[model samples]
Target chain A: MERPARTESPTIGELGESRTLARILPRLASGDAALLGAGDDAAVVAAADGRYVVTTDLLVHGPDFRLAWSTPFELGWKAAATNLTDVAAMGARPTALVVAIAAPPTTPAAVLEGIADGLHEGLAALAPGAGVVGGDLSASTVLTIAVTAFGDLEGRAPVLRSGARVGDVLAHAGARGDAARGLALLFAEGTDAAGEPDPERAAEVRARHPELVAAQLAPHPPVAAGVAAARAGATSMLDVSDGLARDARRIAEASGVGLDFDGEALGADLRVAFAGAEDHGLLATFPPGVEPPAPFEVVGRIVPAPGEVLIDGRGIDAEGWDPYSGWDGRSG
Target chain B: MERPARTESPTIGELGESRTLARILPRLASGDAALLGAGDDAAVVAAADGRYVVTTDLLVHGPDFRLAWSTPFELGWKAAATNLTDVAAMGARPTALVVAIAAPPTTPAAVLEGIADGLHEGLAALAPGAGVVGGDLSASTVLTIAVTAFGDLEGRAPVLRSGARVGDVLAHAGARGDAARGLALLFAEGTDAAGEPDPERAAEVRARHPELVAAQLAPHPPVAAGVAAARAGATSMLDVSDGLARDARRIAEASGVGLDFDGEALGADLRVAFAGAEDHGLLATFPPGVEPPAPFEVVGRIVPAPGEVLIDGRGIDAEGWDPYSGWDGRSG
Candidate 1:
């Protein structure tokens, strides 16, 4: 069987599904949680806690990302990072991930390998012991990645968004709005004059604003904080994905309580901080006497005004980033 | 909030993410295994034996299915059915599913609702206690559904494809080649003059060959048979997602053994049975004196010929369907 040189890339069609899978599987390392990894009827993962938390998220070529602005590695990393945050929000430690990717036949098989590498490295960075257990690959015009993550609560109660109480102190544990700001920066300066994403300009922008762009691309969520918060007696917790203000409101609505945040504690410009999304961080509430876990800086206080999310006593609308509200309307 | 009547269909963009989710959530009923279902950051599912089985499969619009031939309900049903089979093949009882779907904004919200209903009903029909506890919705150029299923082993050792031993009695449960034949029927009789899928013609063909088309579109995999095979002391088991010959080769290669199938028991033409894919049946091998569980009919026996998959002593090439090998390059 003849094959391409190490430097050269071949389309998946050229390599065939078996060959393509052979090329990509090595890049994904199995985690300790995986009792049985890929290449079986199904993978078996350990959930010693007896209760496993599960969540899923999807990333599409047009609506979720632009290929010109994201390396295949970043795409995979972001997918893994986002799903891990969801698990973390449940006060669980990520145990395993099952990913499914769809791309065109014309795509280089190496692109998938890169994504696999990203998934591996992202897991290493955010949740060291977690790894890819199983995955599926298919041919599609739009590049897509769907990640489902499982987590172990270590026999602790899962922190629900509805657990907040009126006297609890609200704290946060990661980037406030860096991801959303980075995305704004990309749309502003990373695109071509025609408003389409341009690889060259995006690279230049990333070089200039590495922190923001990296936050938007391959974020390192405080994956360990969820378990820590839960151990330290967190009354309620959730991932601050759709901006602090917006996500806080979810806790407020769910708990039948309100939350007030100090503007200075948001760590960014007030407007950007309030409206920003994609900051995969932990927003948790702790009882008055119990201190929050490290890195969870006190940012707010739970209030009796039900369903209200306030900044310095002023109410704010929940303006989370929503992909289905018809933004670019780009199909392919 | 003003909304359209129940009979009027609206695009996802028109209804927005929140509203769209509100409409779809009611259709996806949670199961008993879910301690905490959707609306939380992640769902909590029971893993009573402390070990869980996981697997994911992606279904795209083109290579996997054609909307002209399959309804949205069928698409969701097949996706859930396939993943559930993977779990069942592990000798585990499926507990929960986390689904991620991506589609264009122009897609009707009802399509997703139909898919949700399909997922719920599919679980009810196959694994009654398993349900969709969590899911993600995203926009994409192509319609894609990724389902990740979790299952409980109930303290039983997982049935792996690599456990087959020589002298084992090979068996199978569920359809053999009806899916492939039905697909052939669709492409031949349900297509327009140019070979493009025609909804009307596909509908007419389905009406005439309901069983065959249903096997192809919304298959009824003998999911429970997997656990039965395991409890009955089967040496190995796997779900027949690919053709019997091809999937049997997986067991042969993994277990370092060979398989011999009786042609007459395949319930279809020899060629089609050996080459057919998407049957979602259980292929298992029991110890010499053990009878396979109910619904599992005797099909063949294991042989000592390493890496050989034979039909009555004649070797057959593994001819399973490969989506990445490029079938029809359709994007949308």
Candidate 2:
């Protein structure tokens, strides 16, 4: 979608932080969760259960994203989605977000406006009623977006990782390897900014692989499924940020149970399903005799002994996106 | 203070993010406010008032600080202190902090450990019983620390900037301009890592001007005074993060009242008091006949409109730290 033209808008450096915030703040749509929104030293968010489930994520320019691949809107959306997934993993409803942005002074004010619009867009599409309540802005050599999301559990006990037991069924909600596939495609086609790739060719690639690119750039995690799984008596749960195999191992170790995956149930290439990262899908386990929630597919079953993960009775490598490895995967 | 030797420690690249987080998490001390702490996807913090005051700040390596000057411990302390001050400004007690750190893989694991230690130290010293509940770790080319602090208002209405009325006395808690002075000293003495100043000389400067350096490195804002001012019926309150003149002007504009400062009452140089940044002191306004709260010294008074700030009957420039100005101040 093409954004409206914002011709002759002053750069952030020209307007200053306060004035830029004033312009951006009005563009953000605050919902019921915000008791008091931006303009205060700190925003007040309604904590319905007297407890707040909070998480934070930081995305840096070179390591986490490249401006050549992502628009400012996508960056804002991804940042919100990444942190909100953590809240969803805990079976909480996302309530509000606080963003801290550090960027070079030369950055245009239009980029900030795009970010604000994207934040509202993401909240409306993913977790309705959630909104940005407050933020901080500062100057830095490189662009960075740090977001913290707050959630309300509504008195439901948080689904913890260490709750799975023998005989519990392992299930997942949302896509698996699409993001990794998208990244692979991006790498296959050169990602260098200076390289000569005609705009028409780039557009053709994006149009041809819309789903793949969207998965990598703007993942739509099944946020409501967390609450549904919790309601259905999910024993354990977590977001699949660092691949299914690696993250499944986390639950196995935490719960002291072995997990046996049904290869056919995965419905994807083994390599892709096991090693894909940034899926943002919720992986959950339910007690015996309990049906898995809608949108949640049963992919594996908890077993006794070893306390490890296996697919089709074969052990698989749990290699996933490790920050130190420098492998390309979503950090935000 | 000299830190203990950490010879032969592995780098973050060697340990990876998960292992590094494991090494760092144990060092963070959780208080009663954290219902569920680290190890979870998201932490649960208690909200006594059914609402949470949230704020965030990001510190970048080159623009915000220099590793040559600030140890990882000091960086962590400053990050926490800066965010906590915003909570204090809202007349709320800080409950928990969520930190997101992005550093190059080549960074030392000991540096991460030092940051964790500093977070605990800052919380204990500034807002006792507050602790780090959860965080995200990512790889970045530049070192960055982003912290989001949550606070509890304890049923008291949040003191806002637009609440000052005519005849209100302006009061402040904590020092003025000391941080700016410290920055000046650092610049004057030279900040280049390659240019070595004698250890004796550096130590001599530090010892002779301990307060200034400490203010710049890790400001000890009188956090308790925020709640005190609120309890004493403060009409308006905010943290003096920018300059006294600039921040005062913010209150004046927001509340539609003029402020007149007593030069002698400032107890500091006019230039320093009005133009310095990052002091993190609490500035508040109280109605007539209300003795300003303890530890809060009366510095000025609210008067009929021009909606401006004046010192000793003379209008002053609202010159404060503007990140775009390229003046050194704590961006975090």
Number of clashes in every candidate structure?
0, 0
Docking class of 1: high
lDDT of 1 by residue, A190-295 (tens): 8878788888999999999999999998888898999999999999999888787788889999999999988787646557766788888899999998889898
Query: Residues B234-301, candidate 2, lDDT per residue (tens digit)?
Result: 99999998888888988888899888898998765657868888888988999998998789989888
For model 2, residues A9-112, the per-residue Cα lDDT tens digits are 78788888878888889978777799999887999989988998998888887667766566788887888888888899999999889888987788888888
Top candidate on TM-score is 1
Every model's TM-score: 0.96, 0.95
Number of the top DockQ candidate? 1
> What's model 2's lDDT at B145?
91
Q: Which stretches of candidate 2 lie over 4 Å from their true place?
A: A1-9, A192-202, A327-332, B1-8, B192-204, B327-332
**Candidate 2 deviation (Cα RMSD):** 2.8
Alpha carbon deviation, residue B57, candidate 1 (Å): 0.8
lDDT accuracy of residue B75 in candidate 1: 85
